[model samples]
Every structure is written in C-alpha cells, then in structure tokens.
Target: MGRGYLTKEMKILVTGGAGFIGSSFVRCFMEKRQNPVVTLDSLTYAGNMANLEAVLGLPRHTFVKGDICDPSAVDFAMKGVGAVVHFAAETHVDRSIDDSGIFLRTNVVGTGVLLDAARRHNVKKFVHVSTDEVYGAVLEGYSTEGGHLHPNSPYSASKAASDLLALSYHATYGLPVVVTRCSNNFGPYQFPEKLIPLFISNALEDKPLPVYGDGLYVRDWIYVDDHSRAVDRVLWDGRAGEVYNIGGTKDKANLEITDFILNKLGKPASLKKHVQDRPGHDRRYAMDSSKIEKELGWRAECNFEEALAQTIEWYRSNQGWWRTIKSGEYRNYYEKFFAGRLAGSSAGSVN
Candidate 1:
C-alpha cells in the first residue's frame, strides 16, 4: 500500500490550532504536505500559542484569533480555504460540570455556525474532531462509528450535539463532511489540566496526584501524533458523512495509568490521592477503530508504554513550560471559575 496523497492546492482551515490536538494537526499538515494552513483559534485558557511555536515562522501557515460561535469570524476564516478541520471546543468534563453554558454555546452552537459557513462556501470537506466520550461509558464491547450516543457529561453531550449537526449538514445540504471520534490523547505540548499531563507535572513536583473516584475509570489511550495522522488520512481518503473511531487499543484504568506515571518518573506511589468523583463520571470508554483500519489502513504505530515514557521525559525537561501556567494567575482563574464545582469537592485519598 502506498501513502495517501492530498492535492497540494487545497487551502485548509484548522480551528483550535493553538491547543494540543489542533496544534499537532497544524504542524503535521505544514511539515508533511504542501498546503496553506490558516489556524483559527479563540486563544481560550487552554489554547496557547506556545504549543505552535515550532511552526509559527513557516510561510505557509497563518493564525487568526477568533471564536467559532461568531458567524462572521467563521466566514472570514473560511475564505479561500478548501477544507475545514473543526477542533475548537470546551473539552474538559470537570469544568463543564461547573458551567455547561459555555460548552453548549461553544461546542454546539459554534459547530452549527461552522457547518453553516461550510455549506454556504461549498468547502471541499469538513472534518470534525470529536471524542469517544460521546458514546458515554462502554462496559462490554468497543464503540464503533455507528454506536449509539450516550454522552454522560455536559462536555460530551455538547460534542455529541455538534457531531450530529456536522453529519446533518452532510445529509441535508449535500456538504462534504466527515467526523472522527478518538480516544484519550496524550503527548508533548498538551495542557496541564488534562489527566496525563496533570499527573506527570504533579508527580514531578511531588504534589499530591488527584485521582477522581476510586481511580478505576478505564480509558483507551492514543498518542496525540497518531491521532493527528488518523485525521489526515480520513481527510484525504475517507467517505463523506462517515464517522471514524481512532484509538490506541490500549485500555488502562486510571490507577494503573497513575502507577505507570509514578514508575516512569522514578517516584514512589505514595503521592496518589483519590478525590470525590465528578458528577456523572463515565466508568469506561473504548473505541473500535477497525473501520479506519480497513478503509484507510491507519493504525496507531506508537507503543503506549514508549509514548508514556517519552511524555514523562518531555515534562521533566520542560518544567519551565508548565511552571509558568501553574502560578497564582492560573490558580485564581480556577478558583473564580470552578471553586465550588464538582471537581473541587473534598474526598478520600487513594492508596
């Protein structure tokens, strides 16, 4: 099988390009393909330009600071862009439990705005990057592209709504749109609030590692780079209006993942602390990416253990990067935004 090739003349718009996964997509597209990338990001607390510092100077890349909910912003950004990769959203579940208003507005309404723009502009394709959380907790079998949506959190519900909206546009107006629901992604340049980076940073500083509930929640992990590659493959070769599930096929319980982090950091397991679980926390999430594997021949090539080791090393050497964000300003923001929220509740510590 040969590598899939995209036409070099397409102008691509990548929303949320300053965040973790979005930044990875932008970098990969710019480095591997000969297409112009216009990054549309709102620069929310999670969307940091430092994540894209590596590709900022590239001539083929451009950045626009704007919200996805604004139709004018979407229209302005879509100009001359043949394809749109929608990645902007309020994604943290704990934060969503505090205030679902933002999530609903940004993830749902914002997605509608983009789809409307894509339809009006007749974009060649629109790729929506969604999550496995939309399927909620899956105890037995893996979630395929056609599984029922059972979103548990406000964040997941919002994403599920957006996924339907994206697909509806394809079905109704004949727009060329595809969706990718992927498993938990961890890698370099990820924000510290996410589980993997949070654990890595806290463990390195000897801070108590916070694990929600009993720390038995299971998640399938995929490296951010691999997820980005899957998205690229889907954009080029996928069938319009289809959904593709991308996962590492490596399921690890939260406790086991924490233990792996501790071992990788050469730290003792004493730092583990279990806190009260957030409301409506899903127990397990797994994805069957066989559809993508069979159609596009894309599979996660990186080993989970190796990726975990590399991620820990990244944080170890990049303390200055995360330290700046862990200061009074960030803490004050958390206090103001989510002080009495579900995630802030006091609970028993895990062994």
Candidate 2:
C-alpha cells in the first residue's frame, strides 16, 4: 500500500523475507533501489515480525504470511513480481538433526513450488539463497563454487537438494536461476538460538556459555548487511544458471569467538562450559568467494572485530527484542542441547 520508485519490471517477490538474512536483504534492497517488494513468509518461530518493523509500513514493501510450499500462495505473491529471491528454509542444524522432515519439505518441496511458479509466471530472475556448509568441512583449502556437495547435516543436505533443483530448472526448463552460497552470518536481529546471539544472551544473564567439544570448530563469519549487499549484486549482475560463493574472509574458532564475547562484555572466562559435540558436526568451513568478488565486484566490507562489537552493542540495546524469544521454547532447547549434554561430564567440562 505504499508508493515505490520501481517500474513495472522491478517488482520482486522475496520468500522468507522475515528471517534474519532475508529481512536484511529486504531493507537493503528497498534502500538501495525503489523496487517494490512483496515478502512471503510462514511466520514460523524464527520469523519474527519485529525484524521487519522498520520497513513494514514503508512505501512499496508488502508482507504476506504464507508458506512457500503452497502453490496458490506463491502464485498470489508472484502476480506482478518480475524476480524471485528465495530465502525460505528450515535452516537450523540442530533442529534439522532432531527432525529433518520439515527441512526436506520446506527446502526441497517449497523450492520446487517456487521454481514452478517463477517459470510459469515468466519471472526474469531467481536468486536462490544457500549456504557454504553444503560443501561440508574444508580441512585445508577453500570451497569453490563447483566444489563437491558433501553436506554433513540434514539442514545443509536439504539446501543442497534445493540448490540442485533450482539449477535443474535453468538447465531443463530455461528458468533464469542463480544460486548464492554464503558462509556463517552474524549481525543484529539474529535469533537468540544462533551461536553468536545465543552466547551473548546467555552471557548477559550470567549463564554458562556452552562450547561444543574442543571448541576448535572454525567458520567464516559475514555480517548480515554485507551478505545482503552480496545477494543484491547477484540478483542484478550475476549470469543465469551460475553459482556464487560469498565469504567473510575472516576465520575464527568457536572458543576464540566465545572468549572474545565474554571479555568484551566484561564477563569471566570461567563461564565457559564444554559440552558433547553434536553428531556429524563439521569441524571447519571455508569459502572461495573470488567468483562473487571478481564477477560482481562485491566483497564483504565489514571488519570482523568491528562488526562483532557492533553486534554486541545492538544486543545490549535491544533487550526487549531478544528477551521475548529467549523466554520461550529457546530456553527449553538450550537446556536440552547444552545442559543435558554436559550433565554427566565431570567438573573438567566447565573449564
């Protein structure tokens, strides 16, 4: 219900635009251009309305609460949209480990529905959001765009399936599809269940900071805004039927990051609690993002230290936003995942 600067050819349909990275992209895309955006989300537990409060009532931005697997719902949102940016998926590794049915249904079947709708509706572009974890653990070198997909967890496997499904459309049916695989994203508005935000929320309340196994698991971290910009670049500049990798260029161990957070918050290192590692937890993930960097001139511009500090500050100021979520099923899940895992360990576990 708002005026927009985009023409008839620029209207975009963004699925899962209410989640962390999706919301960031929606805001960035709107701010960068006057494109009219129609966001379709299922309003799941992790999809919070507060994330889009900034642009909820803005001109040319609309929100539709619906599932991506619903063909009628997808067709409704795709009416005037020229492009589709897919961000909807069951993304949590732990949750997928617990129950993978929803992940496969949402990530695979939902993507199928979206691809069909885009093909039928003559959408100009389809940017499918994916993760670098689909490449599994990179012990030595970085994962290139064409790296073998050895997804170690249900969550990543579902995404990999979706990735292949999207590319198939481009190859078999000539759908203009582009896939983007991004590394770990940490920034403001992330759910309290993610590693960075979870540790921060627990630390604020003087709770134990759970560290998985030896805590040497390494991951490349990218700021959510930087990721959003990268996605936008792919949407506008990437070639059809190609894949791009987006990386933060900064790799840090889990233990190092948790300690840094505690130190930054003026908390003690004594809060470190080592728990049993989840099954099939990938030890490391690296990305060779040169494709996106060289092709679209999109590089992650946020420094890790600066962005981490900024994220911590945002959590400090936005207690009301996270306090509500942390007080819900997340608390129970945290207890089950961490406390339960460590309950039988000796005192050495708290080191």
Best by lDDT: 2
Give the poorly placed runs of model 2, Cα more than 4 Å off: 1-9, 329-351
The digit string of per-residue lDDT tens for model 1 on 194-271 reads: 999999999989999999999999999999999999999988887888999999999999999999999988898889
Instruction: Supply candidate 1's per-residue lDDT for 334.
Output: 33
lDDT of each: 0.86, 0.88
Q: How close is candidate 1 to the true structure, as a TM-score?
A: 0.91
lDDT of candidate 2 vs native?
Answer: 0.88
lDDT, residue 324, candidate 1 = 68
Cα shift from native, residue 63, model 2 (Å): 0.5
